[model samples]
Target: VVVVVVIVVIVVVVGVVVVIVVVLGSNGGNVVVVVVVVVIEVVLVIVVVILLQVVL
Candidate 1:
């Protein structure tokens, strides 16, 4: 049950991040900025999953 809630929150946050990143990209975000943002988001997702694995 706790895991389900955590997964839901992660999914929501990821969706929001994707929308914001896409909007920024459309609004003249440089390639480097986009790449950095993507990499950081990937890292964040990995970290969260790893933490969840440990916790659960």
Candidate 2:
């Protein structure tokens, strides 16, 4: 379970980084989009963590 959580977090982080890079490259860095992506990523991670805790 821990390993899975770690992997999920890593994947999420990598995905967010890639998305931010792509967005910046294409749109010349839109702060609103970046912020929204980050917020969503954070919420996803938090929800995953909470679910894991509840399951365990």
- The global C-alpha lDDT for each of the candidates, from Candidate 1 onward, is 0.69, 0.78
Residue pairs with colliding backbones in model 2 are none
Error of 1 at 35 (Å): 0.1
Candidate 1 local Cα displacement, residue 39, angstroms: 0.1
Query: Could you tell me which 10 consecutive residues in candidate 2 have the lowest summed lDDT?
Result: 24-33
What lDDT tens digits, residue by residue, belong to model 2 across residues 2-51?
Answer: 77788878978886887768776877557667777778788878988798
Top TM-score hit: 2
Q: Which stretches of candidate 1 lie over 4 Å from their true place?
A: 1-29
Worst 10 residues of 1 by lDDT: 25-34
User: Model 1, range 1-56, lDDT digits (tens) per residue?
Assistant: 47755875776587568767676667655555557766776776787778778878
